[model samples]
Target chain A: SAVISQKPSRDICQRGTSLTIQCQVDSQVTMMFWYRQQPGQSLTLIATANQGSEATYESGFVIDKFPISRPNLTFSTLTVSNMSPEDSSIYLCSVVSFGEAFFGQGTRLTVV
Target chain B: AQTVTQSQPEMSVQEAETVTLSCTYDTSESDYYLFWYKQPPSRQMILVIRQEAYKQQNATENRFSVNFQKAAKSFSLKISDSQLGDAAMYFCAYGGSGSARQLTFGSGTQLTVLP
Candidate 1:
């Protein structure tokens, strides 16, 4: 299992503003995933970040709205651009390796 | 594509009692894995138990055990002698065996242990 550190743990941003969440893994992993959980809702996959390549976004999510960057195997960033009130949710980053997946503490974003 | 389902949205158990959480998954891949994760209010996900598909024997960890029904695509978690520390959200997850390790998680069941 790998430990993941995510920051800013939480933030309150204006509707027009943007926020970038960073996730760093203790060890190298082949796949990293970003997920969003709306209040009292299930987790939804945003995208899959592969090191040194463009991230693969899930259906209903676009690269422009949630751009992802994986500079290396141990680091990835997810940027929520042109945010809106609907973007208010908890964003979690998870790393997958050796048949196991470990998640970060998660970033709680509130867009007002 | 795989989908995990947790029928109960919330459950309550008295301290020192046992409770079971039901989970069912729909997947075409035979070589997959099931997992149970606990998320406290702190929002950090912790692995509680996991069951490998190939193994016929169920997995047990100290006070937690899983009844895996491969044929029925069902996996249920049983927590024995529940404690206040077990009050949290439990999520059932499924993943494939190969390079794709992305886990499909069910809608979590919020467990509250009454003391």
Candidate 2:
């Protein structure tokens, strides 16, 4: 299984501030996914990012609000822009290979 | 489009007992993959088991096993001799074969294992 290192692990930011979460995989993967798991809620797909191209955001999610960057096969970043209290959630980065998927430990964000 | 459904929002089972979590999904693809992921209080996403739509035999790993019915589009997870560590939120996910193989997850079922 591939090991994913995600940071800052957690953060507390004031409303209207923005935060960027980074995910680093131990190995190279073509595509990486970003997901948001709200407090006591299920995981929602934010976007699918591919190396060297634009990311595809899911319905109800926008590139302006949740921008994703995949600079290379092993690194990707998701930025939550203009954060609000509602933006508080655990952000996860994941990759799938050979019918199995691996996820990062997740970044827990709290906006007040 | 694919949608995974987990009818039970929460469930409880006595330690060392057996419990099954139900899951059903809707998809048009003939070949795909179904997965059961466990998220504990630590919030790490752990893959419990996986079943291929093309395979008729169920998939199992230790005490965790899946009952997969391809025609009914049903996949269920059964944990035998459950332990306290089994308590967590369980999510059922679906992924179709493609370049953009993103997983569609269920709402999730919170399992409580009582000691």
Candidate 3:
């Protein structure tokens, strides 16, 4: 298992502002994923980020709205741009290690 | 594309009893993995169990076990002698073989363990 440190744990942002969530893995991992869990909903894949490359966003998600950066194997950041009430959700960072996926504590974002 | 489905939105079971959470997924890939993750109120995602699609035998970890049917594309989690700690949101996930094949999650089932 990999230890992931997700910053802020939570945040309260205005509708027009943006917030960046950082994910730091204890070990190097090639593929890291970002997910959005809306209130009372299942986790939806926002994007798949591979180190040293651009992220692949899901169908309903876009890079402009949810920008991802994978600077290295162990670090990645997801930015929620132009936040709205609908963008308020728990943002999670996940990594696949030893054929199993491990997640961060998650960032609970509240947009008002 | 892969989709995981969890029909039950919520379920309850008495303490020390047995409860089974149902999960079904659809995918075209032959090589993949299925997982059951428990998310407590703290929102820390915990991996409960995993079943490799190639393996016919079910996967078990202590009281948590999975009934995996490859042909039916069904995977279910059964918790025996359930405890209060087991109460949380359970999510079924699917992961295919390739790097481009991303992991998919089900809508989740909220399990309530009554003491």
Candidate 4:
């Protein structure tokens, strides 16, 4: 099992500003996933970050809005840029190791 | 593309009783994995159980169990001796093998444990 820690557990951001959420794992992992959960909605995959390459984003999400950086095997960062009220949601980081997936506590962002 | 569906939006069960949460998925691949995750008010997603499509026997963990029907592409979770802590939002997920292991999540089912 892997333990993950996400920074800025909860944040309130102003519109047009950007907030970067950091995810650090206790051990090295190959694939890291980013997800977004709107209020009263299911989670949607934002992107998949692997070390030494660009992240693969899902449909309806663009890097211009959510840029990801995976500098190493154990760490990654996701930046929510040009935030809006609609961007107010919970962001989660997940890692797959040994065939099992684990998730971080998640960051709750409220854009005003 | 694979999709998961959870028909139940909300359900209530008395303490020490049993409750079942329904989940079904659509996938073209023959081999895949299904999972049931629990999210409490803390917002942490905890994996409650998992079942591989090839496995004929159902998977069980403590008080939680699954009824995985491969032909029907259905995986339902049954919780016995329900406790107050069991109250939370339950999500069903489906994922493929190796390079195709991206998870597709269901809408979710909000469970209330009545005292």
| Candidate 2 wrong stretches, greater than 4 Å | B98-100
Q: List model 2 lDDT by residue over B1-115, tens digit each.
A: 8999999999999999999999999998998999999999889999999988888999999999999988899999999999999999999999887654879999999999999
For residues A1-112, what per-residue lDDT tens digits would candidate 3 score against the true structure?
A: 8999999799999999999999999998889999999988989889999998899988999999999999999999999999999998999999987668889999999999
Cα error, candidate 1, residue A102 (Å):
0.3
> Candidate 4: where is the Cα deviation over 4 Å?
none
Scanning candidate 2 chain A in windows of ten residues, the lowest lDDT window is: A94-103
Interface RMSD after interface superposition, model 2: 1.4
Which RMSD does model 2 reach against the true structure?
Answer: 0.9
Candidate 2 C-alpha lDDT tens digits along A13-110: 99998999999999999999999999988899999999999999999999999999999999999999999999999999999987678899999999
Q: What is the lDDT of residue A24 in candidate 2?
A: 97
lDDT of 4 by residue, A19-99 (tens): 999999999888899999999889999999999999999999999999999999999999999999999999999987644
DockQ score for model 1? 0.74
State how far residue B65 of model 3 sits from its true place (Å).
Answer: 1.0
In model 3, residue pairs whose N, Cα or C atoms come closer than 3 Å (at least 3 residues apart or on different chains), thus clashing, are none
- lDDT by candidate, in order shown: 0.94, 0.94, 0.92, 0.93
Candidates 2 and 3 compared by DockQ, better number: 2
Task: Using TM-score as the measure, name the better of candidate 1 and candidate 3.
Answer: 1
Q: Chain A alone, TM-score for each of the models?
A: 0.97, 0.98, 0.98, 0.98
Q: What is the DockQ of candidate 2?
A: 0.68
Instruction: Kindly list the per-residue Cα lDDT of model 1 for residues A8-99, writing each as its tens digit.
Output: 99999999889999999999888899999888777889999998889999999999999999999899999999999999999999987767
- Residues B10-97 of candidate 3 have per-residue lDDT tens digits of 9999999999999999988899999999999899899999998999999999999999999998999999999999999999999876
